[model samples]
Target: MASSLLKTYKKFKWLPFGNWLFSKAICKRAPYFATIKPKVTHLSSGRICAEMPNRRAVHNHIGTVHAIAQCNLAELCAGVVTDATVPNHTHRWIPKGMTVQYLKKADSDLKAQAQIPLPREWKDKEDLIVPVEVFNSDGVKVFHADITMYITEKS
Candidate 1:
């Protein structure tokens, strides 16, 4: 059975600008993510892609995308992809911790992709690591994050 988020995506993914609207709806639910103004470009069972514009709002004092903004984009992709892939109603997940590396200065708009292998079977509890990579407009990998999610059966 598909998660509600996945079902919703399937329902609207073919519509014009549906992906953009879906991203906006997610930002509305998690208002803090609106800070980065993320645009989710692709979403599927085990992979997700998103973009963060390089605007003054997300710029650092050095005139590049702030480190935290990239982190935000990573978390957004990880969380949403996990939510969309995991079995819904029976399980819940939350961020346990994050380990990140700033490979290079992010000077332009950034794109992020998160990926993980689908579990063969859901367990009672598990710590899932979702890896996310962020690239600049020129396609240079500028940031990376391994977000740990604590998932448990909803009793």
Candidate 2:
């Protein structure tokens, strides 16, 4: 069975601006995510891609996208992918921690892609690591994050 999030994605992905609507629905549920104004371009069982504009709100003193803003994009992709991959009604997940590296200055709009392997079975609890990479519009990798999610079977 597909997760509710994945079901929502499939239902809306074919309509006009559907992906953007799906992203907004997610933000409505998790309000803090609205800060990045994310647009989820692609979402699947184990992979997701999202983008954020390089506007003044996300810029730093040097005029590059702020590091924390990049981190927010990373987390958004990671969390969504994790939710899409996990079995609905059987398991739930929360971010445990994150390790990140900023490789280059982000001067353009940024896109983030996150990937994780699908779990074959459920456990009482496990730490799943989702890896995400953010790239500039030129396709240069600018930031990377390894997000740890603590997943557990629902009671």
Candidate 3:
């Protein structure tokens, strides 16, 4: 099992599937991150770019990645931003709606990015549109999902 994991790790450094390594552990076995996984490839307060592979389980009958999978990535992309924007104890965030556009077929791995640049006029009750960019392994834009998250008082 360890050898196989080493093989997979060698094959894809982005394994340990679903959610950022700093967030949580999803899969605990070989190809450990074969499940839903996210790796923060780049990050900033206003922007964050992550990567997650298009595994077989996420593919539909057409052998392409499922739209839901893309949605999940979009959500995750926004979610990570909350960690920095809201902080661990001060605020909480949840998905309000998803406006997604499937621009092309995803035949390879994928990268999901969410840019949360705080607007100058951002009111206390402002809703945020986390612009998530999804790219295929070839670095082609495959999908785009704007996930809105409403932040409010936590009780």
Candidate 4:
């Protein structure tokens, strides 16, 4: 019981907010996402995850997370992961484009998780697709996006 509690405590000790705070303080030159504030919900291994609730105005007249907002969410997740994964001196990452499928209208809080291919390697400059799944508060997959990111490597 103590071990379980300690594990859980340790997990929460370094909250996602702490990680985000550290990221924000240390990495300030993040392009496109510099001014956008996204609450980081999870980050483990090379995966970065986030969640945002759709307010009344953040949606379209149909009331949803909005297509553009969904794209933003995808970008934020992929950007954070790339920021955390790639070495600054040797690599730079920029989002190229996103192919998204709106499975349903997200009326509640939405969860977005970003992940790259396992055992990521930076052999050469390449374009990569980082897949993110967005789930609604009811745990339904309301959206899925494959974001293309252009990565440049320093020789």
Best by lDDT: 2
lDDT of each: 0.90, 0.93, 0.65, 0.70
Candidate 2, 11-120: lDDT as tens digits: 99999999999999999999988998999999999999999999999898999999999999999999999999988688899999999999999999999999887656
Report the Cα lDDT for candidate 1: 0.90
Locate the minimum summed-lDDT window of 10 residues in model 4: 1-10
Worst 10 residues of 1 by lDDT: 116-125
Find the 10 residues in a row with the least total lDDT in model 2: 116-125
Shift in Å, residue 23, candidate 3 = 5.0
Clashing pairs in 2: none
What are the per-residue Cα lDDT tens digits for candidate 3 across 55-123? Answer: 788898999988887887777667656544553243456668889999998878898778776743333
User: What would the per-residue lDDT of candidate 4 be over residues 60-139, giving only the tens digit for each residue?
Assistant: 78876678777777777887666666655677778888899999888888888988666667755688888899899889
Over the stretch 1-155, how does candidate 1's per-residue lDDT look in tens digits? Answer: 77888788777778899888888889999999999998888888888999889999989899999989989999999999999877887889999999999999999989899987976577777999999999999999999999999989999
TM-scores of all predicted structures = 0.96, 0.96, 0.71, 0.76
| Alpha-carbon deviation at 21 in model 1, angstroms | 0.5
Clashes counted in candidate 2 amount to: 0
Worst 10 residues of 3 by lDDT: 1-10
For candidate 3, the per-residue lDDT at 76 reads 67
As for TM-score, the candidate ahead, 3 or 4, is 4
Q: Candidate 1 — which pairs collide?
A: none
Off by over 4 Å in 2: none
